[model samples]
Target chain A: MRTCLIVDDSRVVRTVARRILEELQFSSREAGDGQAALAACQEEIPDFVLLDWNMPVMNGLDFLRALRQLPSVRQPIVIFCTTENDINHIQQAIEAGADEYIMKPFASDVLQAKLVQVGLL
Target chain B: MQAADFQFLSALIKERSGIALSSDKTYLLENRLGPLAAQRRLNDIAGLVAQMRSVRDEELIRDVVEAMTTNESLFFRDGKPFELLRTVILPRIVAARPKERPLRIWSAACSSGQEAYSIAITLLEEEGLLAGRPVEIVATDIATSMLIKAKAGVYSQFEVQRGLPIRLLLKYFAQKGTNWEIAPRLRSMVSFRQHNMLGECAGLGRFDIVFCRNVLIYFDEPTKKGVIERIAQVLAPDGVLLLGAVETIIGLSTRLEIVPGAAGIYRPVGSGPRAAVA
Candidate 1:
């Protein structure tokens, strides 16, 4: 079972994603914000990280940047989950090393495609 | 406007955003850029793009992109989901748990706090469910601006009416001109914060009833798998997973034994989590 880290600040988003993941058959972990996410990583490293873009106390972009800075933590494959649909924002996420970008209110099929696109599936 | 320009624009939008614009939205694109192009005295979008690349007004680039991103939100747009929460879900959750255990509920993509507040109103009404109890809701979102707004707990009347009932509007909220603020007591019941669906969920502990409704459908298959796996980790064994009306876990994981008689509910079959069993 692949252990995954859900990095987001919204509890509901975390819960919903967690529920979906449970249905998918992968073991999961969660963090509420970027700061907490980093801390969670220390306790138990995850196979993949689902990073959100906007947040307090370290947004997703900053978190991704910070994650790259640490050499000890084995980096997980990440996909940017956000509602920002601008070209530059998408390019920026890709530039920041995100394997893919997903929009908000997306259907499960679309999310699955993005996962496969990024090779995490 | 031209065939090639429209194709380029569509490709750019698709690449940058997952919104699948229909073929008839050509004028909508025109509307988005017309004012700016007119203000710059440019004859057309080509002139504007050329000028933008030359002078590179970074703010303009940002503004344009920001405008394109969809931030549309409303209070309780979907009534049936909340109906399930107040009527069917909460009762089962309370009955399944041991006494004195704190009830934790999460609202996944809590846009501007309305959904969380809606839950609060519903909880407040069910006196016996939480008469002398502790039930804290953790409301989170990925938008910083929205989180700030959610924390404020204020909304215009128009913002309130989308799904708010009149009884709730009168009782749990206070009038502030055209806007209404959810009562302080109701506001305090929820812990609002910034969260992304693609990261770690720490310090949140576990939840009995999770309202992660209608936030998925944006990720890829692997991301979905990864998300489900993580959710299973923190969920209490019998904890119920509530998804959007259109969402499901049919092709997903094996951890959750699909609960019979429930449309969108799933739970762990065996002993919940072995790590915490002892």
Candidate 2:
């Protein structure tokens, strides 16, 4: 089973991902914001990351940029699961090093597809 | 004069392999073709082009292509794939197999044979399921000369030192003069041959693991699709197909799916779980 870390301010979003990941036999951990995510990343690196874009403390893009800069962290398949799906927005996440892109309110299959594309599935 | 020679080599490579060198790589063009010019008793690059164009000697054309082909490789090149293979792929396969049988591997487009030998050495040092199995690793390249050098299995100290850990170097290789030659048993495990990715690969058999990494970057879209399709046909249903990190089969062919987070690692089209299969 793969390991996934879901970072979102929304309790509902994190709960939903927890269910989906659990169903997929993925061990999961959650962080309410980017700072928590970064800390959890240091504690134990997950094989995949579901990073919400517009979060408090540090936004997803900043978090991703900083995450990539961390020497201890290896490259993990990360997706920007955000409400923002604009082409330029998607491109920004990619430039910041997201492995895949998925919009918010994504179905389980869409989440599955994103994970598969980056080799998490 | 240099301009005339540059275009000649570029056009030859384009026609021969369908790989168009951007007009800007004049230095590379000159460097790769300079030796061929000397061999033909030519004074300069222009004279060499004239000789090559005169007869269209297919044998000489093959020689030019072999000479021009990029032979860049290092031990433990792209270190992560080997890590994944040891910690992830090999054990999964060994457990899934029915009995203690020989496992098969093919390193398609195995340039200068570093990738194949890396895999071999990794298996030799590996613990658990892969430790005991008899593995036949077929390493094929498009360049006959490269295959010959690969068959020699000798490396200068510098070449051996890179990508290879000191511990492994002490264990797997023996010093001959200033060079290191792979142990005979390890050398026997890898069979090197010439293989063209764009041509018929029907003669080559199937493999449980295929490492065609970084090879398709040189091919056009059609050639890439054709080569990948042919490999898909020969890859075992449960096998792994590794491509370069930036490369993907996306929107090209649906037969293989990404093995998420493993970079370009792919599973045979429909073999993985529903999550993996689109």
Candidate 3:
């Protein structure tokens, strides 16, 4: 099964993401912040990463840049999940190598579409 | 059926129900109406059409039209539009409405009442925002069979399983043996009626938000334009219209414009043609 790394600060958010990912038949590991996420990535690269924007100890953009520079050859398809929806923020996230961005409070359909767009499902 | 019978049936359907049927739909007619033919003891579609042409049987005509019109729908089908309704449209309308006036929503061509009930679920979930404001959900459909099922608000497990989230299924539904029924209170929030889209809509009154999704694609250009024109009349000045994800009013009507940042959502243009359908 494909593996996913979920990086989010809120327990509720992480739990919801995990449930949805697991339902999609993905094995997952979680990190509370970007530092932990980077460490996990260094240990083993996941096929997908559902990253949050506003976590402490290293924000999402910085972590994304660091993750890209990892010595590992495979690059996980990153999806940035956040409440920020303006054009500039979305553009910046795309430039920072996010495969897609979904607004918070999205239903499973949206997640499924994003996964399909990224060819993960 | 022969080509002549197919042509007659297509013309009859268009005139009766405003549904434009093309030659490609011969298979569709065969698939959907073949059993109706057997019940009527007709040899085939050609025989059914011959009987209808000869006698103009009203019941057979109704059955034929209803069968041809697709009623495929599910709870929360294509989730973004509902998300937009819950997050943006409802809050905007509530904040703008006067204190005493109740919010009105119409699910036009509401198939099996899932669209209307889905709207109710959203309103119920956002009770804190409502703050005692009243809300009415009016759902209308052309198919009486679908209306009956919609009014009952009951579904088989397989029906509920499609497009309905597990969390919502647990919260708003009660188990009836192997099936599930919508809670009485939630079912009561919506009112269903057997109203044809081609008929007068003034009797339904005005609505703040109208869900007319996935209904226009079946119509010819003229019928589609006519239906949308009538819809524009019954919509409140500031109200919005939500169409199917693939549908749009861009080429069909000039009175409505798509809302920026929201796909398939539209608002009426004040300066455009507002002439009533004669």
Candidate 4:
């Protein structure tokens, strides 16, 4: 089965995302912050990463930059899920190697659509 | 609501609009019309139905029909058709059309104008391919309320987030309070009109492409065939018709045929590449 690493500071957000990802037929792992996510990636790279914008230790943009540099043959597709709706944040996420950007408080269909857009689901 | 009331309202809706509600849509009637009834100071669905039966209030009838018609839409609702337009359809039309005659597109049943505006955005992005040729988009719906909203070009935060990418949203829309309003340039490209699919299409003129997506499913078989036949009449010799992903022309019309390798895309019969452009 395809796996995903969901990195978010909030446990509630991580739980919700996990449930939605499972419904989409993906096995998932959770990380509280970006630093932990990096460690998780080092342990075993996932097929996809649902990263948050703001978190302690390392932010999503920084993790994305670091994640891209990891000398792995198979790179995980990063999707930035956050409350940042502005163009600048989106542009920054794209430049930092995020495959897709989705706004917060989205329904499952919205997330599913983004996954489909990135050819992940 | 009583079964008779449900029967009356559903029949009334079908008569006015081509939308055919099934027996299982009782909750739909109550859910949609309940608020409408409250707004109009009617006691309940019963009062609403009684009012319609006794009085010949065209405005009330129109409101009921509009309420029942689903207005759920998002920008670039399905991404595939827009991609097809950008790559395959527009290029062909632009190559064949005369310089003086602008390429025209019709967004039939364009609820709140997303489909029409999406088409406009596609044209704007392909400015290089268009080579300075003019393009016009006519967006029409049976509901005047939807047409008014479409003309405004304002979308909620949720609506904009559905299928619209951040790049296009940032480029084409300006933030207005919590909602994003489409730029004036994009808004100017489309003209909104109150039109019924069952009515005459001659007034709308010929279209190089027609997007009649997701609306025909609500219609019965005969109504679906009638609508497609009418669209075929107004379509240019090489015009393309894009339906919803699930919609097809099979067993519906002899006037239209599905374009192979392109699901939900259709063209008028005998209007192949060899046919001269009118």
Candidate 5:
């Protein structure tokens, strides 16, 4: 089964994302912040990462930048999920190597479509 | 809400709009028409039916028909068809058509214009696919209210969120308070009009591509066949038709045949092998 690392500070957001990813037939691992997400990545790289923008210890953009530098043959497809909808943020995320980006408060259908667009599902 | 009333309303709606309302749609009728009844000062659906029978209120009938028709749509509702259009169909059409003749697309039953606008965005994003060739999009619907909203090109935040990628949303739309209005460049490429699928389509002229997705499922078998035949008439010999993912033309009309390896894409039958795309 494809594994996903869901990085978010809020437990509610992580739980909701986990449930939706489960329905999409993906096994998920949760990280409270970017620091822990980085640690999880070092231990075992996931097929996909649902990263949040703002968090304590390490922000999403910082984590994405750091994740791209790591020495590995298989890099996870990063999808930046956040409440941020500005063009500057989206451009930065794409520049930082996010395969796709989706706005928060999204439904299951939206997530599935994004996944399909990224060829992760 | 009674059986007889339901039958009468369903029959009336089917006759007027070619939308078949099955028996299980009782709750749908009540849910949609309930507020309409209250607005007209009727107690319930039963009273609404009686009003319809007693007097020939053309406006009231039009309102009821509009209410029952589903206008639910989203940007890039299904990703595959649009992807196919970008990679396979448009390239072939652009290469085949003469530069003097502009490419024409018809979005039949386009609710609030998302499909047509999505098509416009696809073309715009292609950069040099059209080169210097012109393109035109004609979007039509049976509901005047939908056409009005479509022409305005304004969408609520919720409406824009569904099936619309964040990047494209940021690139193509400008924020207006809580809503987003489409760019004028994209708006100008498409023209919105009120049209019924069952009516004559020859007046609209021939189209290189027709998007008639999702609407035909509401029609009965006979109605579906008639609409398809009419579309076949207006479809250019080398044109393509896109239907809903689950919709099929089998057992309906022989004027069109499915394009092998392409789901939901059809071409005019015996139109020569030039219509096929790699």
Candidate 6:
């Protein structure tokens, strides 16, 4: 099965994302924040990452930058899932190597659509 | 069973439900009706046929027909049609409609109501764009059992797990023991009824969008043509018809034309009847 890492501070969000990803036949692991997510990626890179923008210790953009720099890490599909809906923020995330952006509190279908758009689904 | 017996059952199904069964479908008929025969205390399919010949058991016949009707369905079964609805069709319909005109959607052969529910969710999510426009979704099936399950809006865990996103599932369904029941809001959006495609549909009135998906493959050419003609009659001139991905009205109906840029979508021809309802 394809592996997915769900990086979100909220346990509920992570659980929900994981459930959806798993439904799409991907095995998933979760991290509460970007710092934990970076460490997890270091241990073993995942095929896909459902990353959230806001988190304690290390934010998503920082994690993405650090992740892209790691020689051990291969290219992985990264989707930003957050409440930040502004164009500027979204453009920034994309510039920082986010593969796609999905607004917070999106339905499973919407997430699935984004995955389809990114060719990860 | 003998060839005559197979012929008898196949003809009966065709007459009653417009479902064409070829000789190769003998296995399908036997497989589907085996348990029904056992339930009726018949020895086998031949015994079941003998019983049918002896008595006018309307209920038994209905059960046989229902058993043969395919109830296969999934929430958002295909992604493209729903995507077209979200991006292009809904927006165009919304823009073309006069203010306060109701949007009527019909889900024909709506097995177990998943397709209808999925449409309702799509509409509900677009409430902002609708700007308080009234939306009505009518879900219909030939089988009473399917309609019952649909009306109850209760689904097994396995059912919801198929093609249903967790976010919408959590939002619209509440746990009922091991199964999940659709939330009252989403449930209320759809009204389930029993309908036959071969029968007159005038009583159901007209619709802006009709989803008659995946049901036509069971029909022969004449039956398919007749059904499409009736569907066109009840469709608003600007209304769209959605068939199963592989199903088409190409040679069946001249009353409609395909919607460009989308597969399996059609609209009534220019000379067709005007809008029956908003």
> Best DockQ goes to which candidate?
4
Better model by lDDT, 4 or 5? 5
Q: Per lDDT, what order, best first?
A: 5, 4, 6, 3, 2, 1
Q: Candidate 2, after superposition: displacement of residue B21 in Å?
A: 1.3
What CAPRI class is candidate 5?
Answer: acceptable
Residue A106, model 5: Cα distance from true site in angstroms = 1.7
> Residue-wise lDDT of candidate 6 within A47-108, one digit each (tens)?
98999999999999899998888787377888888887554666688778887777665678
- The prediction achieving the highest lDDT against the true structure is 5
Task: Report the Cα RMSD per candidate.
Answer: 25.6, 15.2, 11.5, 2.2, 1.9, 8.6
| Candidate 2 local lDDT, B1-278, one digit each (tens) | 46766778887786666555776767776787778878877887787778787877878789788877888786877677888888888878877776576788899888777889999988887745565777889999888888988899998755664466544655677777656788887899899888888777767887888888888777778778888899888888888888887788887787878886778888876686422211
Stretches of model 6 off by over 4 angstroms after superposition? A1-40, A49-119, B271-278
Q: Which parts of model 4 are misplaced by more than 4 Å?
A: A69-74, B275-278
TM-score of chain A of each: 0.90, 0.95, 0.97, 0.97, 0.98, 0.95
Which ranking of candidates, highest TM-score first?
Answer: 5, 4, 6, 3, 2, 1
Angstrom error at residue B145, model 3 = 0.6
Inter-residue clash pairs, candidate 6? none
lDDT of 3 by residue, B223-266 (tens): 99999999999988788889999998888888888777688888
Deviation from native of the Cα of residue A118 in model 2, angstroms: 28
lDDT of each: 0.68, 0.78, 0.85, 0.89, 0.91, 0.85
Task: Give per-candidate clash totals.
Answer: 54, 7, 0, 0, 0, 0
Residue A103 CA error for candidate 4 (Å)? 1.3
Task: Enumerate the candidates' DockQ scores in order.
Answer: 0.01, 0.01, 0.04, 0.54, 0.42, 0.07
Between candidates 4 and 6, which one is better according to DockQ? 4
Query: What is the lDDT, from 0 to 100, of the residue A90 in candidate 2?
Result: 62
Predicted candidate 5 versus true structure: per-residue lDDT over B1-278, tens digit per residue: 79999999999999889999999989999999999999999999999999999999999999999998999899988878789889998999988988888899999999999999999999999959888788999999999899999999999867887777767887899877667899999999999888988799998989999999999899999999999999999998999999999999988999999998888999998875677353
